[model samples]
Target: MAATEHLLRQGSFPAFFGIVAIATLVIRYLYPDLFSQSPISKLPYVGTHVGLPIQKKISFMTNARKLLRDGYRKFHIYRTETALGQCVFLSRDSMVELLKKPDEVINFEKVVIKDFECKLTKLASSEPIVPHTIRSDLTPGLVRIIPRVAIEVARTIDNELPATDSWTAHNIYDKLLRIVAISAGSAFLGPESCHSEEWIQSAVGYTIDVVTGAVILKLFPSFLRPLAAKFVPAIKRVDRHRAGISRMMVPIIRERKEKANTPGYEKPDDMLQWMLDKAPEYGIENDEEMAYVQLGVGLVSIHSTTSTATQALYDLAARPEYFQPLRDEIAKALQESGGDFTKDSLYSCKLLDSFMKESQRMSPISMVIGKRILEEDVQLSNGVFLPKGTLVASPAEAVGNDPAHFENPDEFDGYRFYRLRQKGGLQGNLNQMVTANKQNLAFGYGKHACPGRFFAVAEIKLIVAHILLNYDIELADKSVGRYPNKFHGDACTPDTSKQLLFRKRLSGQSEI
Candidate 1:
């Protein structure tokens, strides 16, 4: 009788508590505002809905000028969701102020690149060398050898284009990939290694896989991302591709080291040799490890060059009338250099430079300029204060398209900057036309500006010049009025699906 009484008392206690719990839940659901004030509101479920309004608001302002005829110069916007997200979109004056203080306010190497190195590749084992190393290593080499490298690569591509002429339809992306891969590989690595089929394919495939995977990984929440990344098939693909590249590179590096030690061996004039010489400065001694660094350069050079080249070609094919003037310019430059693609000759093609600059202005790689995160509390000239870890950005698209800066910003004017240079205005100012200011933001600016740009520009010009001189090109779909456009968050990409028609031009007619 005593045991039965004890059991009945325990059962009553649980029942009593269950009723109270149910009552609390019912009241909370009925009045969401009561629960909204609590820290639980930020716990994923509630945060998603809370963030929707801010996301929608930002999307509207970003696309406003493009869709609307309003002459809005700048817009101030703020997003609040447990954490404060504040940014000012400046068009005319403020854009210049923000870009001018890139070192003090903009820690691009630490901010824009931190997430990539720490979260993606874990290359932060050493000091992060983004814009710095890129500047030092690429500038000198590019200025000296890029034109020569481009000529060699272009010759290889020109040989391949004749075969494509017989085909009814061809994929321009695939062809561009081949051209860029060969050119970039030959420039970065020695010609012997670049010519190998295995090396070219592995380098190109691994770069695309790793870069694309890294981008996807950046989109997830920190806590859940590691778990998701492990299971992602794209990550696996990148890993596999990297391993293949390593396997090929290891043997090649060993052979090069042996040759270097041999007496009276002539040194190669390629980026691989340059990187090998500089490896000791970075504390990289092992031949295999140094080869990996070379591989990284190949990845950066090939992808960026290929994407830009393909876009330029697609633009040329879409507008056939623009072809003759560009061809004439290239021909005159080549003729001036005794019919050779020399470094000085490449620079002489002012029209080619302008055309490429126009292509980048119309379709930039990203919509934001100098993306950074504050390391500590910072105040901008516009009176906006950014807290630690807050992501900051400038309006690249709006600034590029602003009518106050460029006349008729929407239409593609190939001779715009070239004409400006002809009038004895500062050519250095035109360089800013491609920077992260009120004009354009293709390669970024200041200490963090893309170091590989000089080489990239030279390579693109050489390839295009060679293609124009050797081949007669047209769009497979002649009716296609404009290149397809792609938007990812704030970035824009040219249509990769378009095809180009290529036929070998007669030797004398190439000049026309």
Candidate 2:
């Protein structure tokens, strides 16, 4: 009995358990897709020395472009395995077919919901309500929305930017972010709540928290997200932001609902009211749900607009020569419209539009727009078989930089597309940034393309018009063109910390 007790106390049981555990982990790490028969299962992997797990992390962090380009060169549609699962890379030509499939076949919401673990985080839902609200009211009502957008742009620029005739250096991305938050909040949440400093803070927090959470959650495999989600600080912050937003919005919604119950009460035609109108049917009526849905709209409108504007400003600052030409155009447009922003006035600045387009073309936010996870086994137009759970994205930068599409694709010719517009041909409309097609996927292409693009265009142009008309801006380092976007695997965003110097326009320079 004494001898048996000594043997047990030596930790033989623990040793056996530990060995089994280690063996299980090794197999799991080595063969993440062992159960799947997808082409990804058989494809030659990236790195053998460091193993698949460590190699994927290093290459993705250090040189994603080289890794991506190497794979793209070898196979037009090749697969790479990661801790997060296999992601398939396709060339520009595959986009036409990839986009043609219905939502049922190639589900986008599922991908977002899966990658971001939206179900666990509840930061952004996979519902059709936001899209429906956008398609039905927001885009169609751009002309009406433009005035609201312009007013907010004017107010925000004045309030957020430094005052007259003095040069002040600022983080342009941060400035644009705050400006977009205020303006987007005004457009999205309505006038009363948008002005509340607390609400603006929460709104901005929501965008940061949700995106950061999504990115962090995506670092793990799909199955591990739920368990890993709790450890991610950003994911937890999303819940806190949601709670804050609810405190602000609950009363407004309750009052709106109560008022609608009153006889002859007219409901406001704002985004909140729109969501409320769809609530009962969509089953997203709670204050928390309402706040999240609207924040999702913020997700679409704020960052994209702010990022594009920031980089565009950087581009303009880098080339200060465009400042006068652009200002002159805005001055003429303002005078033509009697010192007001209208549809005709905004679009009339063709050069300004072209500049914005070129900046976006040069600095796109992602390598693939409208990326999706395959819900079922599917075949592409090129006869490649993509199995269920396959991740795919069509080429964005490749198409934008292709010489076959644009003249001097590598150069930043502010007036290149505008010149093409002046010569107005069948492809001239394609030159416009908002015109989404096979070639230009900045706003995406096909039925699922962004619905809020019209509002984005008007809002961006108005803000730029206001700035160009009021201030003289310059790059901090005129020698360096602009800072490269921060890249994370397939994602890209402007470095928000980059600063710029802006001074008020000299007195007597008001052409309007």
TM-score of each: 0.80, 0.88
User: Could you tally the backbone clashes for each prediction?
Assistant: 0, 0
Q: For residues 261-361, write the lDDT of model 2, one tens digit per residue.
A: 89999878677788799889898757767876766777777888888888788888788889889988988888888887877788788999999999988
Best by lDDT: 2
Give candidates' CA RMSD values in order: 7.2, 5.6
Give the top-scoring candidate (TM-score): 2
Q: Tell me the lDDT of model 1 at 394.
A: 55
Residue pairs whose backbone atoms clash in candidate 2: none
**Tens-digit lDDT track of model 1 for 1-512:** 56546656778757666666987776765444456553323222211223343453354434533421222332322221211123334333544555566455555556534434335542232333323455566566665566567666766776556534353355767777777777777766766677777667766776666656656665555676677778766667766655666777778777777899889988777666666666667687776566566556666677777778887888787777877788888888878877777777877777778888888777766655666655666555656555565555555665677677789998988887777667655654564233333344667655455677877777788888877777777778777566676765455766777778887664535673
- The alpha-carbon deviation from the true structure for residue 375 of candidate 2, after best TM-score superposition, in angstroms, is 2.4
